[model samples]
Target: MLINDGLVRARGVRYATASRFAKPEPLAWDGARPSERGPACPQPPSALAALVGNSVEGLSFDERCQVLSVTAPADASGLPVMVWFHGGAYVTGSGESTKYEASLLASEGVVVVSVSYRLGVFGYLRDNLGLLDQLTALRWVRDNITAFGGDPANVTAFGQSAGGDSVYALMLVDTENLFHRAILQSAPLGTRSPERAEMTAALRSSISVDESTSVEDALAAQTAAVTEVGPKFPPSGGMPFAPVLDDVDLTAAASRVELLVGHTADDGSPYVPSREHWEAVTELIFAGGARELARDWAAACGQVATYTFRWAPADAPLGSCHCMELPFLFDPDGWRGAGMLAGQEPDPVLAGTMRSLWAGFARNGMDALPSRSLEFGG
Candidate 1:
């Protein structure tokens, strides 16, 4: 184990294996082994680097990226588990990013797992292979997290942006009781995923890239495909690759677990040029979708909590945009150079409270949540 600051950290724990553009199959592991950090799925530079900084700065890229990292308190047992999914609109981002180190969250008496799944044409092109990678990771946690002091039955799946979108999708498809609760941070639920017809056409554009294609060529094809077909989807065109919304009934899924879901107060600020544009995008792509999901789940008898993160440096330009709350939930040093934080320190009290609330939710579900419609950094 890679012990750090009294935490037993296991990095690059492979949970599944897959061929290029194929479905992921679960892999067995002998729990708690030391390994190198997994390479992120191959992709282009993050489109949001100007706003959130380069999260994957030093990471290598590879096709076999179905891996995860686990961090837990040393000499602990029976602790709650928090599985994380990093966000990048299904095209970018990796859970192995330094920006997502979970030491702070783990210090709160929980085990944290950060997942790295396939991305772009390598993942979402043929099918939901990236999501299947997540399912395999959850199964791995169920069977092996006990060795690292996590309670298998009390797993909580949490994510942000595309990652958050992923958690919501997992809630709908999870059948093995893989997780009992979910925390969806800034999930863009209002962004419509491409239908089958659209996906098929997009798939056709990247059809030339197979197992033998150079990684660079494959990425180029992925970009070309998006460029060719993205305009049809308009506002969500930049994020053309997303989880396909199939005919899954949410009523059953909704009733199975408690959920905490919401977005930042100015989630669209970084993406838009004006306050009016920010309001439109924030509502249409973030707030509206989040509120709808909470309402639907609650109406279906599911326990739900929501929040609006309004925290930002006093002179920061983005004003609590998407990803602003992340620094509060993870190790401060990891975000030391993050543009999203605006070079100012996150308030220690606020960071501690965010960690406590998230860990509390992992341990006690809805009971850990404050009253609904809570506002942070207001």
Candidate 2:
């Protein structure tokens, strides 16, 4: 049930909801088909459309906004659409990051939309204010997707880490009817109280501003403070920048989405300052608090399809690190062993297998194909 804020205005001719989700009939390509042999590539400039708009929160400048699209071949009817939010710990990254290239999914007849929202102080610092931004993004997608050849009723929201956390939050407070399914990678449900406290403290210290300071002033102080800290990860526990149980956007309750959640075997090493840091984070994020949180999360999910991926490809480096499966999934040859795709080699077979599984999940509520060694229902 979408509560129209009366702020949403459609620019194009209003298409009836019936035309939005109707199954598309397949079309045939008359020209020479491009090579579908190697990694899927984006079609040339002519084939894609671009969209820009204010965030759901209504905070960002009109020009500083979002992007959505239909990337699949035009002929593919009834293709599923995925709205992807990237992982950056609520601080960094953009929709334009190379790691999120959606060509592979697009090639498989999925319309992929990558979003750009406010980051760091701009998006997350409002105590409970930032949630509106996320909600607005979802609402925008819901109202405008049909124009881009997507099914508004069949959308799936998927993300990694912080983005994954957002997926869960969306399900909880999401009254906009924005998405029907969810995929969460390497993110657990909640944070330890101590960890939350620490994050709040760090944000406060960085700002050095009163808790009651105006959002604009707080953002200015935060930007200056972080610049002095250099590129290092901010000290944890500073501000109420992350999602919290506000009873408005979130109700301190569990969510029910067809969840596909898991962590890589070595998800903690990349941020480790030393072996001890590695051990501590692993204990906290995975074995310690995270494990307990997972139990509670499972209870909330009810009859969920669950799985754990222990991917240790032979070519991977010593540490599997966060986001290691991306290159394998996208099979972007150059991106192999860098950023999220670090510690991976280009494996066509693995890429194909993973893409098919993702597509299947987006198309239906299934986790993955039966043929793949991918496990579920644990």
Candidate 3:
């Protein structure tokens, strides 16, 4: 049967089955018939090899939580594995977003897994409760990836924006060596203090409570207030809740992972323009400390693998905005109207270049520079 947006479904799960794409086969049970459902179930259409959607259950801290896992088919010569975290300020976003398609990356002969964890008020509000959900998700990958044809040893952790911030935090907490390599895109490393304070103040302000309020009482009150606001509150400054450096989860430590960091030319523009709200956006999000944070981040990331792209199209109203190069990097088919790729087919030159660079980093700790002429050493 056809699923939403032309995806094919057999049983209850949906599978991407375009003729240009190979169909994934269902996972086999350990000792039962092929028809028997296993703990880790996969999908159908044998051409694609494997596509399994499983969950890592019984998390230690949060009883109701589970980390969703998406495993792709293996490569012809056994490619590496990349565990990707989606960027939505750590408050919003999931692994299932189309913005993070791993098909192109997987085609490079590497298994890719996109992770989903708790978000917003749920994930980042740990007091002394010791909730290491993100780390737990990583541990789950380390333990279970082999079942999905992935090499845990060669895993690379990569993320953008808030996800990128998480990557750096992972480094600080001695989890750097867990992944072979790391890629941080458009994230501010040194700006966490102010940003965390802002998030805390916003959360406190949302509840109209003081800082002395207990975690449990604050959470209860906030939940009630939010419910009064009707299910989900309207998107505002109070929504993108992130982690705070409570001397536990985040600490002062040098990063040990091989880092590849870069920023777009103009990552401060709007995707959809509104003349009325333009002034406000310019004054708030794009002004003052936000601008300085990017520069400060570059300065702080000193001597790491750094490359800056000033991508701009003559017809485009703005230069490279936040997430502008993602489409090119991922080679998404529908992103033709984005940045430099506007009204054109996916450029093989760019796609191949990025794939090779990223693949080399994943395979080894070193970032394979795309061009020798481009200076990557900060």
Candidate 4:
């Protein structure tokens, strides 16, 4: 399992199993060592494929995609663990995507675990199965990550976009303290979960599909449902498959976890066709939402930190847009096909600084922060 740069990788490790539309059950030992990256949850093409490259290209898909990948230094012991949940509006993207390979972060002296959960109708149509899948994965890590040299108690749950939202959501439900710190990048809080009545109506649109339906028919039904319901939730309504909002006290849960959350300078740029529209979207959705969360967390607890990544490749049209910071956190080469990078790799010094800051946070929580608010590039 040892790979380049002295890192040991355990790919396609099954953490849990679930039947269609059911909550996941944790699996401690599957009787077989995982060697290949498991299939991603079946999903349609990403809406952001033109911005970030199509991550699912050439990747396999299945309903049973509750797997995680681990990468750690060959000699690692008791290292801080950073568990990643990829972002694709909770519809697409997988932890096994090359764009998410953790060699760079692993080389930075921490253990990284990338997770893949169910997506789309299979995950969110009638139940919060995907989020439950994440909780199940966390439980698996708590019970077994020690074998991979990660400190179960020193875990940092971090993600971007929907994945970032997933991390923020996890803070409210992680009553067992599975992770002590969180990093949320470009989480679109402006599009909060719809009211239960609204969600119920939306779910009704896909009532024709069920556990026995063919995957193609299910996906078609999901698309039809979203098309019918999207207009009701304007602006960010294009995203309907979201975490179901719970009755937890946001202030209390956010206060307990050390948090570092923020968005890119142009996070909404990729969604709009022009600079003006993009600017408006960025402020209304990404920037404003993250700033509001940071303010609320700071008022409730003193352990919150925030940041803004403003760096973009020179002349890049999507300047510092969503997913821009990912190249710095992982291997830039992995994102070579992404249009957002403009054929330019992330600056090495900046990438190093970002990685160090992230790894340090995993190691020491908010105390590792250089400041309460930080700006990178531009």
**Scored by CA lDDT, what does every candidate get?**
0.86, 0.50, 0.47, 0.85
Rank all candidate structures by their TM-score, best first, as comma-separated numbers: 1, 4, 2, 3
Q: For residues 101-166, could you state the per-residue lDDT of candidate 2 as single tens digits?
A: 566766766767665544555455445333445566667666656654577788888877667767
Candidate 1, residues 25-94, lDDT tens digits: the string is 8888966476578889988988789777888888888889998999999987999999999999898989
Error of 3 at 294 (Å): 12
Each candidate structure's TM-score, on Cα atoms with residue i matched to residue i, is 0.96, 0.67, 0.62, 0.96
| Model 3 lDDT-worst window of ten | 12-21
TM-score of 1: 0.96
Better of 1 and 3 by lDDT: 1
**Candidate order, lDDT descending:** 1, 4, 2, 3
As a whole number from 0 to 100, the lDDT of residue 169 in candidate 1 is 88
lDDT of candidate 3 vs native? 0.47
**Model 3 Cα lDDT, one tens digit per residue, 1-378:** 212222211111111111111122222223211211112111111110111111111112221222344435532234567777656555444554445555666666666666555544445544301124455556655665665556777777787766676766665554435665677776644344444555555564565433455445645665654445422322223223455654443222323445666665554454235534543433343333234533444455522465555554445555455565566556375354443444544446666767667777777655366542232111
Off by over 4 Å in 3: 1-65, 71-78, 127-131, 174-176, 188-191, 198-202, 208-240, 246-255, 271-303, 334-346, 370-378
Clashes of each: 0, 17, 2, 0
Prediction 4 TM-score vs. true: 0.96
